[model samples]
Target: MDGVTGLDVHTLGIIGLAVGIAIALSFSLMSLVLRGMAALHVWAAAFWLLTFAGLAQGYDENGSFLSAIIGSVLIALANAAMLIGIAMHLGHPLRWRGPALVIVLFLLIQVGFMVWPPSQPLESAVFGLKSIFWDGWMVFFLLRAPRELKAGSLFTALVFVIDALFYVARGLVSLHPEMESPELASLLTTSNYLFGILCTFLLSTGFTLMLSQRLVHDLRVAANVDGLTGLLNRTALLKAAAPVLQANREHTHAVLLFDLDHFKAINDRWGHAGGDAVLQHFTRTLREGGIPARALLSRYGGEEFLLLAPCTSANVAVTLAESLRALVERSPAHYAGEPIMFTTSVGVATGTGTHIQRLIDTADAALYQAKRTGRDRVEAMVSDPSAGDRVNEATSAASALT
Candidate 1:
């Protein structure tokens, strides 16, 4: 069969072989910089080696069974390397047993072929069965992967399934005498070779997309999460809170600012590492306590945190803030086999308007008041003159109590 520009099967194989080598080199370059990209590098190398083996056989048209047998062995190793690369990408523990066993089996198959050479049909059947089983195995891992990777994995798995079916069809065709005619056989072989190259291209594209998707996911997590406390950082908190503030303009929402009292003294006594331990302990306590899931807790700054709770009145906000204060005072952070007790001052402010910044400012003022009056206490300030007379009066009453 002549492809575009009258290219024969041998020419196509050479082209495929060239493309495989380029892909291998590209992956090799990437592996040097990107951690874990070595797996993909190995996959590309295996693919190229298999292509090299096929090209070798094509070049040696003479009855040198040795070249073909060597190609088969390379195919076995290539399959094993492909599996190893996939397992590494999926974050599975790399195991040597599977690839080792595949190598051993392929070596034995070579010996068996040399002893009593099987017919074309028998050889096709044996190879096809092994290919189908391994392809199925690859598909299994893809299907069982995480949801984030499902789309890409499934796309690649479909290619593997199609390749498996191709082998099965080839094996069946080899058994039929009519299909074995020189013309029909040549056409079938050319078609198989073309389809195999297409499958390789698709697989490579899918794998690249998988890596990109994971990189984006990881970057998002890194941007949003606080490295020290694992809470949402200040920037992320503000981004998340903006929508909630807009929607709850008419509803009551509370913003509580928490500052660890005398935190500088703790840092001075325990050093920075111990101070880090205390901060971690405080964040853990906030999570473990009955903090509502709907609320957003963020590390506001060095020793300060912010909790934004929607649909809560001034009275409820005060109660919640008082509970948090007590919880922190009770929880002691243990470091270096000694208990380090600490206390927090909380400032509570309720808002019935769309202005998040105003609420935050009011909460900060109350927090200042809490620290000024005394540490380890909760202070309320719901003073918003613009939010109608009733709201202002209610907030004024709460402020008066504080």
Candidate 2:
């Protein structure tokens, strides 16, 4: 048909071949990276490859019923495997039992496709839909991922999206034309050649956006996290705290403050270099044990930390503060190849009509009280739940003990 028409079949074939190779290589590379990160990554990457492969093969001859059945089975299995693996990595990775469940779904879909088999011209649609799934995931990861790799992954995904769209458009134009031409043959052939070239240009632009997004994401992360400990830095903390401070101040919330005991003396004895090492180690320890889903952990200053847990009661905040203090005190400290012990003091205060600044002042007073009475303990201003009751307690204590 292409030969009878005045279309450049040679150029069309070359363009298609180039795109197919690019898509295939992308899958192989990404699959390798995903596999290194977690199991079933290959399944996700391979789905894109197999979809293109099916299109290239099916175009030769509408795959026979048996061939389509086999091809469909492979594609379905790949998709199912991808969904299962990603769901597992989210937490509670599925064992062998999961693959068994996924295979059942694959077999069911395989049976359906086998019965119908090549009823519609599915080549372009097959390629497009499959790429959309992978591309969606790539965009999602780019948004949420912690580092640079997230951006790189997106470039390949964008190429697939463009390939998928052009193929779908090509299919639509070939099947349903708005205007009828005297020589439909030449029109169809010429359009196919033109679309392929268009795809190449789109692919280049999409990749540019993908890489740019990655660079921006990485720079933002570097600014937020402390270089040594990978914890949020002081600047990051203040910015993060601003919203919470306003929220709790407007609607009564609790705050817990902590300061490491004898931190200065230890740093003075074992150089600032060793001090930094110890601090980084301590940050790691805190990060290891999971924090509350809503909790924000930030470094307030040197030797001081803030755990701002919103919508919490004063009593509960005190309990948490004490536990954190105990944990830090128990953690082993090594400097200059020698074991050293350290402890922290905590102060808890709840906001009612108090501003964030006033809350910090109250908490600081309680922290000073902890140090004065005995280090390595938790002291809370307004130990009672009722904010009004705290003023009464302070007054009574001052009058009698005065």
lDDT of each: 0.78, 0.58
- How does residue 369 of candidate 2 score in lDDT? 86
Off by over 4 Å in 1: 1-10, 36-77, 87-119, 143-151, 247-249, 334-339, 383-402
In order, how many clashes per candidate? 0, 0
lDDT of 2 by residue, 109-171 (tens): 546665765434354344445545544543443344334544434554455556556666656
TM-scores, all models, native as reference:
0.78, 0.52
TM-score quality measure for candidate 1? 0.78
User: Could you tell me which residue pairs clash in candidate 1?
Assistant: none
**Native-vs-model 2 lDDT?**
0.58
Query: Which ten residues in a row are the worst by lDDT in model 2?
Result: 393-402
